[model samples]
Target: MHSDVPILLINLDRSKQRLQSATEQLNQWRLPFTRISAVDGKSLDENTVKRVFDEDNARCRYPYDLTIGEIGCYLSHVKCWQYIVDHKLDFAVILEDDLCLNADTPKVLDQLRKITTEWDYIKLASPYKFRPYHIVEQLTQSNPTISLVRYRQKIPSGTVAQVISYRGAQRLLQQRPPFFRPIDVDIQWQHELTLDTFGLLPYIADNADAPSEIQQLATRKALKQRRWVKLKELLRFKLKI
Candidate 1:
């Protein structure tokens, strides 16, 4: 049962190579998708960044705009939502420029489509290492395992990818709040509020290769200091005291 759902690929205008790799990967997997680029025409100026960040509502707990790289990704997501509305697509799979799919993604997505009605949201087909306290157990023998957890709960594993239904898409559009520092972290934190978000543990674990830029930036030499900064921010946010 092939639905007329669209898959949106978020990419940056300058990162042509990464975009090409992502497209090739999608083609290799034979998944139906459309590519969208977030173009500012001009370079990443401080003014542009501030303008985007300032657009976010201040009422939300997290109200910060994205960096240049992430703004591109978010714009892609926004474009995907717009495409759904314009083309009348029910749902779409939103993939970032950095993520690569595992072999079992097609099968997992197939299964997800079968049980779409049963879920409020369909997260990535990969497994996520969420905080132990945040992991909820299944209460009923339902079709798929989607349990309730805290909205602010943190996940240990990095964000991979996921599929979203029309309803899920609508919810995201409605709550266009500034996410945590990063969009991925915000997605994971807000997953619980949505209907359901699942992870294909084995697939993600097997495909643990980082993007070229990410690998270069997050080198061992810089990792420790970066981690310390991130942890400090996390601790401050969690305590709130």
Candidate 2:
């Protein structure tokens, strides 16, 4: 069903090993997909950085300043969403460079095709650690397999693996340039996207064991310290005495 849907893999130009792994895995499944070259933040000029971090629009609401790698990652996703819109694909599967998929993936994908109309987006990979959900309906009653869910307490995170409909792509395309948040967090905004989102249990796709190039550096730790600086500024703004 979704077998024909275009699949796009986002990989950095320098990450050859990761690209090799992703390509090999797709070969095994005989899944046709396009590999996109990610934007290299290290190459960005001062003007671009200022634009991405504009003070006026409050781009990137993260507690910490976004690392160059993180910025690059976000831009890569934006490129993919734009590709979806440009190609006018009704639905497409977007996968990050590193992911582990089980044999059940094909089966789950087939099930997904059966229920595509029920959702605009479905997370085949469990991006969030935990999120509360109520079973909207069962895909096959036989097993907890593909099921429609209404996430009560959380929105999906992690750009590991997911299916996006054309409408979903349009919603994402609207949020262009100087992003206000990381790609995953921004996508979770249901009001912004206005789409039905669901998830799969016992994920067919999970992040791979390979090291994360984006966060492999001290990205998170630096962000943590940056958070303190931002917090102090916020306190000063609030205290009117």
Candidate 3:
């Protein structure tokens, strides 16, 4: 029900079923959000695709040819960033359509807002656990909750949920279009983007059970690697979150 920090849901118009389900979940929580139509990579012009490919600089990036869905997802989030800049908002919570938010989501967001101005970005829904994150601060001792964490050179997880400020949007847009790497990887290049980023502990959110549009076109080999990465992330999940 907090409206101070605008909530934006990145969604593809084609994913009507998912959108409906996502909408229902959000509505049930009585949380307000804006749904931004995701950029459809399949319909992107050749030149548009070339530009993103030109900007690709991901370390251990996507192995196969970038799928239209992946590209679309990237463009869609960038679009949300642009919206933040355009509206001049204090910050915005960008949630992917397949997002799961529990009752504590509001509390987590409230604690996040306390430090929103201190950071350019904060990952809210991390699928797999990651480590070596320099803990910047802790908000709750009883629950072992972290207020902030430095990624240094690693990203915690997917773009399922995160909060980014207006300045963060500006820094992220510097990467420009035709970004070769995945959106998740692009935001972690702190040295490159100079984004003051952090991740929350015990992800208060996760994705809903649904097929991922981005992975629909992935090759068998790529899928294997993806699973391996997930397994590693799962280990992180067991870290007493």
Each model's lDDT comes to 0.50, 0.70, 0.72
Off by over 4 Å in 3: 55-63, 140-146, 214-216, 219-241
Per-residue lDDT of candidate 2, residues 54-139 (tens digit): 43444323455567676777778778888988998877788888887776666566665566345667777764477778877667
Candidate 2's displacement at residue 70, Å, is 1.1
Model 1 residue 49 lDDT score:
56
Pitting candidate 2 against candidate 3, the one with the higher lDDT is 3
- What TM-score, over all chains together, does every model reach? 0.63, 0.82, 0.81
Q: How many collisions per candidate?
A: 7, 1, 4
Write model 1 residue lDDT over 127-181, tens digit each, in one string: 4444443433332243443333323345343433555666666666676533334
Clashing pairs in 1: 124-161, 124-162, 126-199, 126-200, 127-199, 127-200, 127-201
Better of 1 and 3 by TM-score: 3
> Which consecutive 10 residues in model 3 have the weakest lDDT in total?
55-64
Q: Give stretches of model 2 more than 4 Å off.
A: 53-60, 116-118, 142-144, 214-217, 225-241
